[model samples]
Each structure stands twice: as C-alpha cells, then as structure tokens.
Target: MFNSIGIPGLIIILVIILILFGPSKLPKLGRSIGESMKNFKDSTKDIMDDDEINQDEKATKENK
Candidate 1:
C-alpha cells in the first residue's frame, strides 16, 4: 500500500504530523509508539512459544 507513496509522500505525511502535533509532542508520541510496538512483539512471542509447546506435547502423545 505504501509502496506508491514514495519519499515525497512520506515527507509530506511527516510534515503534516509535525504541524498537527508540533515538535514538543513528537518525542512523547514516538516513545509511546515504540512502547506499544514492544508490547505487541512480546505478546506475539509469548503466543508463539505457547503454540510450539502445545505442538510438542501433541507430537509426544502421538508417539506414545
């Protein structure tokens, strides 16, 4: 979807965000975005680990 936007479009979007939020709030906004991404990653990792464990248990039961 963003492939067509290219550099100029991305720059324009950033400028609009800056104008709306201002420079002062950008850092906080960036930090919050980063933290939310981290939390999402962690939760996904946990879910994947649980799935792996469940598959391993099923395989073991089938072998028995």
Candidate 2:
C-alpha cells in the first residue's frame, strides 16, 4: 500500500508534519512513537511466547 509513497512523497509528508507540529515538538513526537512501537513489540512477543508454551503443553499431554 505504501509502496507508491516513494522518497519525494515521504519528503513532502515530512515537510507537512514539520509545518504542523513545528521543529520543537518533533523530538518528543519521535520519542513517543518509538516508545509506543517498543511496547507494542514487547506485548506481541509475550503473547506469541505464551501461545508457543500452550501448544507445547498440549502436545505433551497428547503424547502422554
């Protein structure tokens, strides 16, 4: 979907964002976005690990 938005499009979008949010808030915005992404990744990883553990337990029970 985002394949069409190449370098020029990205630059334009960045410029628009900079204009709207200004330079001063950019760092805070980036930091918040990074933190949000990290939290999302961690939660997903935990969920996947739990799913794997459940599957393993079920497999062991079936074998028994």
Candidate 3:
C-alpha cells in the first residue's frame, strides 16, 4: 500500500517537519521511535520461540 515518495515530496515533508519541530527534537523523536519498534520486534520473536518450544514438547509426548 505504501507507494514510494518522489524526491520533491520527500523534501517537502522534511521541510515541514523541520519548520514544525525543528532539528533538535527530531533526532530524539527518531531515536525513541526506533527503540520502540525494536522492542516490539524482540517481543514478537520471543513469543514465536515460546510457541515452537511448546509444540516440540507436545510432539515428544505424543511419540511416547
């Protein structure tokens, strides 16, 4: 669904953001957003791993 942005559109969006929040808070905002996304990814991976372990245990029990 996400079409790529043209160069002009990208520049305009960046300019608008710079005008609104300025450069100072932008890095901090980006860092927090990146960290939040990373944490979400890690948690999802942990859940998938747990599911795999549970399935393996069930298979082992059924084989006995």
Backbone clashes for every candidate come to: 0, 0, 0
Residue-wise C-alpha lDDT for candidate 2, range 1-64, written one tens digit per residue: 6689998999999999999999999999999999999999999999999999999999999999
Model 2 lDDT, full chain set:
0.98
lDDT of 3 by residue, 1-64 (tens): 2258878888998899899988999999899999999999999999999999999999999999
C-alpha lDDT of all candidate models, in order: 0.99, 0.98, 0.93
Over 9-49, each residue of candidate 1 has an lDDT whose tens digit, in order, gives 99999999999999999999999999999999999999999
Best by TM-score: 2
Instruction: Give stretches of model 1 more than 4 Å off.
Output: none
TM-scores for all predictions:
0.90, 0.91, 0.79
Better of 1 and 2 by lDDT: 1
Runs with alpha carbons beyond 4 Å of true place in candidate 3: 1-3
Prediction 3 global C-alpha lDDT = 0.93
